[model samples]
Target: MGGLIFWKLRGSDEKPVASVQPPPPATTPQVFEQPPPPPPPPPPPEEDAGKKPAGKVVGVGGGGCAGECKGTAGATLQSALAAKAGAARGCYERGLRQNATLQGKLVISVRVGPGGQVCSAGVASNALGDPGVASCVVGLFRSASFPAPEGGCVDTQVPMNFVPKGGGK
Candidate 1:
């Protein structure tokens, strides 16, 4: 019974002790801190950068700038007519806009230069609503002429409209 009691005393750890040594200091887990976020991107340059150019793009589509080509000193009547015809063909085909077809005539006014390039062009539709046709017509105008038109003028009536079985604006 004495031996058993001694063994029990040595084996036991839950019982209170008369003289107790302080427990080792507790250790806490290390923490990690996150880095700061990156800076934002810069903005784009403005359209009118203050020192204004002579003109801006009012309206444009399909190709180059409208008044980009400076009309040369003079242009021939033949060249003007040729320009008109070619423009007409392209306009006719492209006139087939979405879900609709149209037909009509218009007057195409162009200011040409001696170099045969079209300085500027305008279309007065005899019949309206074929936007595609007008676009195609203008597409023909771009880069088509060589020498510019003569100072006087060349005005002609052109059929600027949509046609049979194609599309609408």
Candidate 2:
């Protein structure tokens, strides 16, 4: 099955299971007076495959939009969730305008303990370019929490898109 990994791998040295594939050399060298150059050679196997592909990382900082994360309970908790959504939108929009190649959505599930503490957090949905920004967001929500609404448990899902506003750079 296809699974997502939201890991804090910044500066994490890559441990190649196999040899790294080198990119194909450009066949078309634009030399004036020279005939049109040939097409570039095919890239080597997995030349462009790896963690954190060429894409912008859109960070999200809220939970609540679909109410599928934190359990639903009271007005304060609901309001906090709404606030979280707005924050996520801001972060996404900022990333989009930066000419970054964003093309995915990430949903972060924040778990609030009985005492209204952020006890745990995980990625709910990682797709498109979603997983790219998960690590950064982990720290953003580490200190966040919403009181358990009085009704049932509350689990909020805050999703952010990584698709750049324009195509890509």
Candidate 3:
């Protein structure tokens, strides 16, 4: 037949398909509001205006020198070196004797024991190449002594500049 016609059976074994539905309309998203932040804590109260602030007094020495004993470590080392300046000069003189043209700077570290005696000494920096000169300088420092520190030992580094006699500037 030119135009075909199809017939449907009502009581067939095949099941009917479900119909499709259109999607729901779009809507604005809901937002949950957050609570405000807590306030900052109050500052501590100021001290009494009439009363002076309490402070611990650190005494380097007894009586009159208590307050004037600033930088005791340095002062002690300096005084100790001053007491041994002559011997240190001698060591430098010896170095000069070895090499008439020897001129440079030497830095040495000295450790003062608890009993105020130099426990050890070593050259920290040396521009002078002579081992004899270095050893002489170290020996001079090792024989020096300093005032005993409050409770323990003290260490200090001293820098010495060497220049030949009659050398200018």
Predicted structure with the largest lDDT when compared to the true one = 3
TM-score of each: 0.42, 0.43, 0.51
Q: Write the per-residue lDDT of candidate 1 for residues 11-86, one digit (tens) a residue.
A: 8867776997899988988887777777775554464553222232222222223334432333355555665665
* Candidate 3 positional error at 77, Å: 3.1
Please list the Cα RMSD from the true structure of every candidate, rounded to 1 decimal place: 11.2, 32.1, 16.3
lDDT of 1 at 145: 62
Best by TM-score: 3
Tens digits of lDDT, candidate 2, 6-30: 2435325556578778999879977
Residue 75 local lDDT, model 2: 78
lDDT of 3 by residue, 12-131 (tens): 546878997888987979888888888886654455422221211122223212122222355666776765644566777887877788877778887665456565689998886667
Over the full model, what C-alpha lDDT does candidate 3 score relative to the true structure? 0.63
Candidate 3: residue pairs that collide: none
Q: Choose 1 or 3, whichever is better by lDDT.
A: 3
The order by descending lDDT is 3, 2, 1
